[model samples]
Target: MKRFIKSRGGMTGFVLLAFLILIGLAGPLLVPFRDAGRHWHDIEYWQDSPAAVPPVWVRGPWNAGKLARSGRLQGKDPVLFESEGGGGRAVWRFMLSKEAKPMRLDLILVIGGEGKRPVLVSSVGDDGAETEVARRLFEVSVGQPARLALSLDGARALTVTEYLLPGETARDSPSIVLVGQVSGLLGTDVSKRDIFTGIVLGLRWALLLGVAVSFLTVMTGIVLGISAACWGGWVDTALNRIYEFFALMPILPFLIVLSAVYKPSLWAFAGLALLFFWTKAFKPVYSMALQIREEGYIEAGKSIGAGKMRRAFVYVLPALLPYGFAVMALSVPGIIMYEAGISMLGLGDGTVVTWGQMLHDALVQGAVINRLWWWILPPGLMIALTGITFALLGRGFERVWSPDRGSRPTGAGPSRSGT
Candidate 1:
């Protein structure tokens, strides 16, 4: 732990991972007040629509007139355009404080050519397309905040706020200036309950089930492996070879064959993984068991008239435990990777919300390449962190159990008291 804290990268990674897991676990609870969930979705939308929305100052030095002069302002450049269009989009930069600022953009809307009011006066894109709806001219006020509905079906309604304020700029990104109020830029419908609660609940179930299945399957393999190794001759030879044969068989073909015969479920995938994963642990554990069975302790147990099962369990299995755990530790990351790969291939249960399934969904939804950073990044990061955590924890435990590792007392090396 001390070494990890001292190492910058290790400390950083560990801290980041700890916080990420905590957030994944407790996000739904803390979301109402902290409002990080809004930030997550807002960041996602900001990045997605313009690819990467720069802060107000990051827009570089450009006057309002310069945007029109540049001829680069049209839908040709994503930074300036609200959406994919042929014409230029109007953008604005606004300040929230002396140091804090928001960026804004004006989207031009063309109302019917009856000298009527403009359809859209918000942010305009290069395509010259703006959302428009029928307006009732019961009252006309220039600087009043009002709720208006756009005629475009499914289009999110916009609140016209701060429409008259000039956009300002600081180090932060742009903000949208409404007609009367200085509110935030238009955002998505993502609520605190929407993104986090589902994700948190989904991930908790997935990871918990994943760990349980892995532990059970791996432990079962260890037991079978030990049996194969200790009871050599026919028992060892036949079973080990049989397991090896199964391990060598193609997984995809097997999944197809198996899923075809029965309905797909999380259990089915876990079972399939166990079948193959157990095979992987067999060889190493069998080797350890073979070695352990020949040790002096086993012979002593035999000389003392210990029964086969008793001697094996008390003496041989205990000796093999260290090696068994070491091998198991190393195989965990591989197991997770393999499971994810199989899930990605669509062999696993579609309803199960494992990290693997998440990746598969991202791919299917086109979010992987769609620049929806939050959607893809969160799942990918989760998979990576989970693998790393298991690997590091396993390594730490292995070293702790190692004869030559763990703590060494001061001046404790090689005592010569007998001399």
Candidate 2:
């Protein structure tokens, strides 16, 4: 651990990994998101919110950035969507822009005089469907942003009656004001799924996969490799054959088939990933274990009546610890890549929320085409950064493990005395 921190490469990897782990542990508790896995229920909170709301901090003050509803405006107020006379029916068509998203429609009109008992507020969709947005008879403040929940449900127009009240005068109908949502620091996707929340939840899945698959493959491979090496002859031949066979296995296709056949699960995909790379640790571990097996320590253990299990595990395994650590660290990036690749391909479980799926949505939704780089870049950058962490760690561990290299692990003594 001291050596790891001292080395620049190792330190770089360790910091990157540690920060991601912290987020994985604490992100869920901090973010305000109802569902990270599926976003269908998110509509209840946002109710047809405008899609792709940019992060506020970066949206400099302009016509685009203005969302205030406090004081009266000099010219026509955009938020106050429509206003006209009262007495007859009037249809205010809000033509949907190409960049339009799910939006909750809101109506706010100040009735000057007295009006009829009933005034209707309805949202009309492009398909000519009518859904009631609101129905009110109460008086509204002369000017204010009402704190009321409304749903446009993808409507393209809002139609209201221009009804006149008694006490004298002209038609004074309700004016429309569309209150768009400015989500969190990161805003939302087309589906109104919060991107920040997705990133937060994804930290857990990514870390779980990177660590689990790394440890599982190295430990399993080392055990099998040492067994083959220590107990040679038929055992060595058979293990080598098995390793070679599995090494040649068409891993991706097999996983794709299984994903189709069974339900997609994180653990299940992890298991398949284990199969794909477990053999990677075997050959190197076997070579080193064989050298250690012929050492004086092995003879000493054997003369003292240490059983094969005790000899291999208690006496021999310690010599291979450095190799194990290096293999584990290096193998992590591949495992994460494999899991994310399959997921991005839509072979992963639909219910799981992963970075790969986030990227997949970006691609499918033409986020790149629309220049919504935020939707696509984050997940890709994370994947690359994670791979870099493992790569650096692997290099550092490799240097420490080499016989003639820097500080070595315990039991990695010189060939003469240590043997």
Candidate 3:
């Protein structure tokens, strides 16, 4: 243990892994927001009252008469969306040209008034879908930079920026939506419940499944490998060849075939990974058993009238424990990575939440395109860290057990000294 901590790489990997696991475990409780899916249900909180309606002929203080000849401004567009961060926000980009051909840009805005709702139109190109900008009243103003509420489709909403005058507000404004009684918006308690909760819950499920699967596979493999190794000759040869054949077989084609036949459940993927890699420890165990079997104590046990089973197990099995554990520690990372790869390819169980699945969603659901950083980064880091932990544990064990490096287990010298 001291050696493990003293090793820089091992310590670093262990710390990173621990931090990631803790975040995955506790993140749900700390989430500040609610379900991103829950929306609609309450609208009154963000609605505008009727009295503050805007009068016609309003224009920006700078371009009051710019559009006067064409028509008088009837009303300003309701703050369609306030930036999520706060203040006026702009998602759609439009350049105001300084060229002689165009003078000043006058925005014809329609805002929602008390009793009257305006139709939202997203600007073409670069900006998101044209959406209804919500305001407290039907009003028009040219010079002031005020908050705009976005009336998103159904119950969802977003806020962006609309600037008529350059100096009135900076190019960056807070995009805020009128969080009303909507289930997922700020006004709705449901909307504000907590996003991290769900994510943490998801991570919990993932870790549970991952650990359970890995433990089962390794334990089973250890038992089978030990059995094959201790009982050499025909028994060992047959088992060794079988394991070797499986190890050599191409797994991709088989994975594709199986995934095509049925939905990839967590157990199914775990089973597949075990099928491919369980035998990895077979060769190591077989070698250990052969060495231990040639030990004087093993022969001595037989000479002392111990039963065949007792001699094989009592003398040889205990000697293999340290080596078996070391192999297991090494294999754990590979198993986890295999599961993650399968999930990333969209062959994971629908019910299980894994880092790979998260990344798959990021890709398939266009989280990248939407720039949803939270959706993709956390899960990825979790998977990576889990793998690192097992790898570090394996390396540490190796350093403590290597014949050329660390001391051998007591009594192992004579029993395993010959072979």
Candidate 4:
């Protein structure tokens, strides 16, 4: 732990990976404010906002022309445009600290998320009576925010509000400017699916697939490899042929076909991976087992009439465990990549929310073209981070087991090679 922390990359990776592991174990509880039961699958029911909403907190700079409730304004950009249920009036209050020259300002009404909803824009006086400033009806597109030109002269105090012309209260959320408690922090997908929650839940699937596949594949390899090498003759020859045959098969196509044929689930993919992944661990385990066969302890056990099971598993397996563990650690990334690849390719179970599935949805939804960057970036970053974490852990262990590695203590030796 000390040595790992001493290495900056390793420490960063460890912290990130640890958080993700906790996310997997705790499920959606990490984001306590979010609805735990509502996931990517349940997105359709609770998609209150328009699809492909950008993060609420991170909008472009609101310029001088945009009405201000409160906050600094920068380069010309859209201010948050929102209306209450029944398309009620939304007031944006602006204050003037000093006498200012009158300047013409254009306030464009950008409608987004759901579709064209006629908005009634008007200025308000101190008495709370609505003034007919700009009461023109304009059609707006879904997921596109368009502003109507409302040029207002400079004033000490200005109250600008929008009202929805009497119409059906939009059941679906407004397409743009959705950033609040009910909406997710990271915003919604193209389907108005909560990307934050999807990411949270996807952690579970990622950790499950990675660890389950690695441990199972390694364990299965150990059993088969040791058994074949110990029994020798026909058993060894047959198992070797099977291993070589699988090595030559097209894994991606096979998995794609498998997903197409069977009901896709986490366990189903895990089981399928068992066929291919074990061989990677199998060869090394068998080599170690064969080497162990010549040891005096094994011969002594045989001379004492020890059973093959006891000799192969009880004695020989334990000796190969360290090497087996290294192989297992190295193999984790491949399993994760495979699962993610399949998920990205649309070969994943629709109900399941994995990192790859998120990417798949984003691509299909044209998130990149729309510049909804939040949807595309996070999952890819997370996948890379997870891989880095495991790689650090695997390398740390490999150093621990290296023959020339000194035991002087972590961060101790100037020249570890000599020691």
Candidate 5:
């Protein structure tokens, strides 16, 4: 542990990995869009946000001070006025600066009771000029809340612009949820989904997938490799053949084809990865087992009537554990990349949010062409950072366990030695 921390690369990787894990654990609680994973693809859920907006922190001369910040009026803030017709009307008023008029405005109306309810949404400017943005009679059912989302985009854009001039205070009936040109921590995607929340939620899935797959693959290899060494001749030869076949197999293309055919879920991808990746740890573990078999302790154990299974498990497996830990760490990055690659090709589970899926969305949505940097960059950077973190930790483990540079595990030495 001390040695690993002393190595600069290892320490850096540890810190980075720790930070990512922290985000994976704590991000959902911190982010405002707690339901982002569930409603990421739901257009109605994200209708309150401006589409393809940059982050709130982004500001420069290139944008010409036209970027408007988002604001919301909800709950008890909107004043409700009871009409003579046994219905109530609510109004929310907010000021828009002359320097930046909101690119988009949304009114969310939640109401209950049966029959059709007439929802009138209007934009009133300082000059008392009023423009009806939306007039819809929505069907409502008792015990079920009906929500109406009225937006300034599309047909109402011209009406809003002509009626609500810049620098004027505007009033919206029902409630005004102003979605501006700049929004959230990492802005909005083409679908207007909060990018930061999506990224944060994705971190948990990525880590879970990578760690689970790597551990399974390495453990499978260790068991098989040790078994082959314990019972040599036919057993060893057969396992060798199997390992060779898998090692030479074109995994990526095979996975792509399989994914295309089956449309497997994330867990299914992990299972498939394990089938191919076990071969990675096999050769090294087999060689190590062979060396450990020739050691004096093994000969002594055999002489004492200790069975092959007992000796293999009790003696050999323990010695290989440190090496296995290193191999497991190294294998994680590959597994993550494999999953990400499959996801990037649009073969991933659409129901779930992942870094690769984000990239795939960006490609399909023409984010690059539209110059939506926030959408493309965050997920890509996360994948790269995760890869680097595991790679560095793997190298550090190697340095600490290498035969030439590092000490061997206690009790692994020749049994004849007194020390």
Candidate 6:
């Protein structure tokens, strides 16, 4: 571990990977919407949020343009005035702060009653100009709730724009609820889903897929390679043939076809990835196993009646473990990329929130054409950083385990004096 951190690349990779892991573990807790991961694709859940807005931090200290922030004013605190025939007027005066220069606004009114009521929603500006934003006849059952959504972006865009001017205050009457313009740490997507939440949730999936696939593949490879080398003859020939077949297979095309046909879940896709990935470390492990088998220790074990399985498991496996760790670390980036590529093509599991799925959505929704950099850049940068993290860690492991490091192979037995 000390040696691994001594290298600048390895230290940087460790810090980066640790930061990513920390986000995966702790980010969701810090986010305002804890259930964003579950409701990411549910448009209704995100209905109150602004669509396709940049992050709040973009405003910076300069206070660039008038950026709208999401806010809601419920009817619970309305000032009521009694009128004739039991019909009354409820007014909600919400101050639009000098900082909240909204580009657009939405008013949602929830009315619960037995008969139709003529509701007039108006906005009051600092100049005492009262503009009627929306007027509607809200009909509701005795207990049932009816929702009316009125966008100030339509014909009233000019009226609302004046009210939202910087350094001015505005008020909405009759319990008008304003929803969305810009919100959240990373802002909202076209669907109004929080991008930061999606990215944070995606970290776990990325790490899981990368680590799980790499571990399974490398372990399988090491076991099979050792078995083939130790048992030799028919076992060696058959295993090598299988390894070669998988090694030469066009995995991407095959995965695409299979995924298109089956539409498998993330775990299923991981299993599919493992089928080909296991071959990556096979040749190297096989060569090393062959060398270990030829070592004098193996002859000593055999003379002492040590079985083939015992020798392979108790002796050979340990020596190859360092190499296995190096290969596993190296293999993670490729596995992650493979999953991301499939996901970007829309062949990945749809139910999960992943970096690749985010990219795919960005592509389909024309994020680039619309210049929604927040949507595309975060996931892309994360994928790149993750790849770099594992690559550097793998290099560090390679440095430690390389034969040129002058460390004796563990399978060579202890020192002569100790022996």
Candidate number with greatest TM-score: 6
Taking all chains together, each candidate's TM-score versus the true structure is: 0.55, 0.71, 0.57, 0.67, 0.81, 0.82
Instruction: Report the C-alpha lDDT of model 5 over 297-347, residue by residue, as the tens digit.
Output: 888889999999988899999989888888988888888788889999999
- Which pairs of residues have clashing backbones in candidate 6? none
Q: Arrange candidates, best lDDT first.
A: 5, 6, 2, 4, 3, 1
Q: Give the TM-score of candidate 5.
A: 0.81
Model 2 agreement with the true structure over 1-419: per-residue lDDT tens digits: 55566678977887888888888788868666655556633465544344765544444445432331111111121232233452333333344222244344343333332424345566666567888767766543544322334455566665554334333233334344344545465666787676777887777888888888899889999999989988889999999999999998988789889998998898898888778788899988888788787777677777899888887888778878877888888888788787778888887766777888888777788788888766777788888888898888877776667635453334433443554
- In model 5, residue pairs whose N, Cα or C atoms come closer than 3 Å (at least 3 residues apart or on different chains), thus clashing, are none
Report the alpha-carbon TM-score of model 1 versus the true structure: 0.55
Query: In model 4, which runs have C-alpha deviations exceeding 4 angstroms?
Result: 1-14, 32-39, 60-184, 405-419
Q: Is candidate 1 or candidate 5 better by lDDT?
A: 5
Ranking by TM-score: 6, 5, 2, 4, 3, 1
Tens-digit lDDT track of model 6 for 139-256: 6676455677776532222221111223323223233345555677787789988888888888889998899899999999999999999989999999999998999999999999
TM-score of 4: 0.67
Candidate 3 ranges beyond 4 A from true positions: 1-21, 24-28, 32-202, 369-374, 403-419
Which residue ranges in model 2 land beyond 4 Å of their true spot?
A: 38-48, 61-182, 403-419
Quality of model 6 by C-alpha lDDT: 0.76
Q: Write candidate 3's Cα lDDT for 1-419 as tens digits.
A: 66666666666656765775787666644543333223212233223211111112233555542322221122323343444455543243333222323332223333321222222234322233444444342233443333343222222213333433222333322222222211211111121222233345455555665566656656566566667766667877888788878888888778867976898887777778777766766676666666666677777777888875785666766776666666766676666666667777887765654556656655786667765555556566656666777677667666555635544443344544565
lDDT of 4 by residue, 1-419 (tens): 45545556545656767887887777646653366334546643543344565555553344223322212221222234444544354444443222234333333334444554444455544445555565544455655445544455553434444454446333222212212222356777767676777777777778878877998999999998999989999999999999999878989899999998887877888988998889888887787678677676677678999988988888888767755665666677788888888888888877777888899888887888888788988888878777877777666544443425542222121222333
- For lDDT, candidate 1 versus 4, the one ahead is 4
